[model samples]
Target chain A: MADISAHTPTSEIRSAYLEMTHRKRLYSGLMLAVFVALMVSGFVLADDRNAGGFWSGLHRLFDFPAEVLSEASEKLTDLPAHFVHFLPSLIETVNIAAASTLFGAMIAIVLSLLSTRGLARWPRLIPVFRRIMDITRAMPEIVVALVLIFVLGGGPVPAMIAIAFHTAGALGKLFSEVNENASLKPVEGLQSVGAGWIQRMVLGIMPQVAPNYLSYALLRFEINIRASAILGFVGAGGIGYDLKNAMSWGKGQYDEAAAIFLLLFGTIVIVDQISSALRDRLTHGARLEATL
Target chain B: MTTVTTDVITDLKGRADTLFLRKRLLGFALPAAVLVYLAYIFFAFDIPGLADRANLDNGKTLIRDSYSYKTHVTLDNRSGDITYAIEGERKGTYPDGMRPDWVSDRDGMTVVDLGRGNSVQFAQGFARIVQQDGLTVTARPDRDGVNADLPAGPLPDMISASKNRLMVTLPDARVTVTRNRVEVFKYAFGWELFFFTLDSPYHGMGFPTLLSKAVSGEAGAIWDDFWGNAMWRHADVAWALFETILMAFLGTFGAAMVALPLAFLAARNFTPLMPLRFAARRLFDFFRGVDALIWTIVLARAFGPGPLTGALAILITDTGSFGKMFSEALENVDGKQIEGIQSTGAKPVQRYRFGVIPQVTPVFLSQVLYFLESNTRSATIIGAITGGGIGLLLTQAIITQKDWEEVSYYIVLIILMVMVMDWLSGLLRRKLIKG
Candidate 1:
């Protein structure tokens, strides 16, 4: 905290200021150097462990995509048929996302209510329920899916349950955040009427927070679509499974692979666009309602 | 004028009524649609056939294996040799002369105490089982398959009888007899060999005893035994856990570093050229649309398989997301702040450094931190595909079809890892952003 310029003449202030700035610059430079070293060493270590070298693999990066694209163009006439062939699988993937989101949202509502302060049925057990949500949310979808596939056999059900489990945990946290901003007046009014817990939640909290919940759910749905596709690649059943098969076939099946890639990409973009649009409207409408 | 006023009031009333009517209709229609969709899914997913295909026994095995380990007491009929093992694995085999308290070797006869007065006596010629209910079951190997003599009444459901084998299922224990061997499995709670395998000297020592030994300068020995546990593979699991976190760290930070500069190019305020900005935005879209799953696949081809490939996949996919988010943040940067800095005759670079970065750092940093937490979960899935990290180990264990205990262990560790990262990121965000 000492200032060397304070005890010196007025002329020394500029020199002291410059000295301080130089020291600050030196500290920042050192920090930057350390960061650079970490990144470089980490990259090297990763490259060493990797099966393929980084530099050699860089040029070949576009090879697979190019092959698939060229082959699809060559068989352009079969593109429509391939699209038809994969449509059902695409539907299945979407269904998985939709059902999981529906089920997960249902569970998340209760969990959020339980975990949120001032809204908890049993305040003492709020931490328990919150931790439960945390653990469930922390579990990656593939862990449960793979484990369920072992017991349930390979099917969409495993994927559905796994995704729903994770979705519940994730949506639960977001729902609770929304719940925190909700007015307690409605809840108190319902309580004065001697309504039951479920009744109070449905008639009081549900109406107040419906818009935010809907928006968050829409976002989750968009995410779940991508997750479902990825799960399919791991053999949970969907277009992802077919894509994997076609991919493994290497050269001959590039057309089918391209079709799948297109389907997945198109579905994702469309869903994202639709959901974002819906979310925008929902929030805008809510703001309008507030103004009115 | 009076008629006009009346007409307007009536029109407003009609509109309100119609709105409520539509709302009511939608309430019913939405539920109806959801029900119809669910019905479609039920058949589409073949839920009806799921019941037939579901292996309830596998569920039972998984649930049981997660909590309880069965110690196998085997009597080799051919060699007249007796051995005891946990989960029937050699890694859990007892030492040369050491055995569990429940099992006693009396001369040539092996007697397994199945608890609560249920004991199985294995001998050279025959095996005898004492049931908790006082039913004495005896099986003798003969030419006409093993002959079993039971109480003269009808056989109970707990006992399975066949020409080749006789089996008795107990709540705490089980006894099975075949032509070749008689085996008894006693069920116990908790994971066995979690700290020290059977070969270790510290296998059955209580926690208090271990602590005392540690205080007596045996700490290294204890640590070595626990760390090198063959059945659990603590060392490998730890390494896999580190690799998973490393993947997330390298990916999230690396993407942030790459995206920050690129974001300036995409930001409309920073880049006046329409075509260049459009191209940059399109590139972001391409990467985002391709997504982490496809990116992982493509990268794994060039990178082969490791944490590096998974990290790069995350880096590429997240670069797109960060670029889009960061460009928007940059575009929204306060023009007044930059103008103020410029009024001091500061260069463009210095103006951005002083005015723009400080404004956007908190928002961008928060976004990056959030991604850091999420990418940890993503890394697990990516690692499974790329053949690295705990995810790979989990799949391998699950595929082997029996190591449900190890699967459960890995799952617990993964959940713990995510929770820790979640806590750590939250802490870092509060500290760095607020400070």
Candidate 2:
């Protein structure tokens, strides 16, 4: 109150502050307006280019599902037989997922160790390995599966290879993140004991990170199961291939489609439950270790 | 202490050794199991049969065509008129009175120089391939059949001779002479006519010349030519890429907007009604369990094939994911802030706005952004199945079984697009959440 000569008027400060807030509000409003416009136009463009108009398609949305449901309900008695028939295909799908996860995890263990800062065999080439993982991770599995289907002639093997290739890249990054938290003391102790590189990694690092690695690998198995099915739709072999064939067969094969659906859905839910339980246990155990 | 029993210590040592032995056995057994399973898969997947089914020729074509292109030199034996085209595409055909540098006409005889002394001379009714290694072959298409003269000393594998046709394969080019026409494929590096089609004046211009032309105010024309390239369909491909991104964008954000409110309905603190919360949660699980593949199939029947259908498929799938994640995030929000807002005499909606939203918005946005990054990939796969985007082009090119170069192009573009999205989403996440 006494330093009037040095102080600015309160009203002037208030107005300036009000002006700033107004401007801020106006800018936010403008951004929202632009976003809304973009969304609207994008929708319209997509609708216009679509073979069936949105409004027309909206009415018929449930037609195929309704047909499948009705036919499946009528042939409910055959569902059991159909399920038995598709069981082998479902097994193949699960096998693709399990095998790919196993192979991919093995590759990821090596890649993760190579890429991790302290655990790397060739520390100088960490960035190189990281970039390789990035490129591989960016490559969509379908591209590989489609190409491999051309070469390998449409089998589960292509799907397995593709999913495994992707899983290695994806799991490698996560595994390296886990590796970053591992203690380096064991590694040093092994080095002092004249342990070779592989021995050091196997005895020193793997035990520390194996739980997290297994958890991630199990999570990957869940994802790979879905991926294997999708690849089969694109012409790789599995339940998805069987599903596509059944779907194309139409009306008469609705029971088969229903059976495959039941198998796939059941398998997905069951695997998800098992893997999540294992993951919970792994993390819980890790937390216990940390607390101790 | 137990009286310092010596037998007890030995028992402990024996147990430790047994445990270690068990672990060692397990280490070997596990690897052996994996090996045995792999052998079973090798037999089950029929690895041996694949050798016959697998088209090694397609592999060769894919590898070769990805990096190099071939120009075709065809002489219609009937008209004696030769036309040259890149990749044998009509859109790449040389216009009248125009030809590549490697090809020339002198006194009604067309000479295709295949470099390194390997050359082909096409005349009135005969063709001569002069190989770089001095092996020569002459083919004259006649009334009965093609008259072929092979070089002495057992015809090499490079040359295939028959009554109706004679084929000579060179390092740089391949020549096939039949009764109807004489064709030679000359190899070159890089994609030809990638920017401008054969009809464009800018097609064969050198960089320096192009710069001068652009400086002379021909930039718009040059761009138009490039963008409108018939051989590449640059405009359509660009549009497809845009559509792919648009699908992912609309799907991810739309799902977020739809899920946020519904997530509150499912959250334990927000929704006290047990039945309603259970219904909302189960709906989310149902949507997720259906997966994007089945959803795409179902939606494709309704909407037909387009980016719209792909968008809807992604939207439905992601809504379930967002609902579950967002509800969990909502449940985790600190109750103290909301209680403070309530104590301030604020209404439920106002309390949510002032207290709850701010705490969870970052979590919500991070999850959405993560999904946006991943949904871009899903959109590509969905596009492949439903017939839209670069995936469609990739599948089409691959299915053609000959246009492996285009498949390579589409693959590179898809990867680049995905990486760009990945970088962009990461940048935005940092800016929005942390900043």
Instruction: List per-prediction Cα lDDT, in the order shown.
Output: 0.91, 0.88
Per-residue C-alpha lDDT of model 2 across residues A112-152, encoded as one tens digit per residue: 99999988989999999998888778788898888888777
lDDT by residue (B192-231, candidate 2, tens digit) is 7888888998877899999999999999999999889888
> Top model by TM-score, which number?
1
**Which candidate comes out best when scored by DockQ?**
1
Error (Å) of candidate 1 at residue A161 is: 0.8
What TM-score, over all chains together, does every model reach?
A: 0.95, 0.95
Q: Tell me candidate 1's fraction of native contacts, as a decimal between 0 and 1.
A: 0.73
Interface RMSD of 1: 1.0
TM-score of chain B of 1: 0.97
**Model 2 chain B: ten consecutive residues of lowest lDDT:** B1-10
Which residue pairs show backbone clashes in model 2? none
Q: Against the true chain A, what TM-score does chain A of candidate 1 give? A: 0.93
For candidate 1, lDDT tens digit of each residue in B94-168? 988888898786767678899888898879658999887789989986556668887788889989989989999
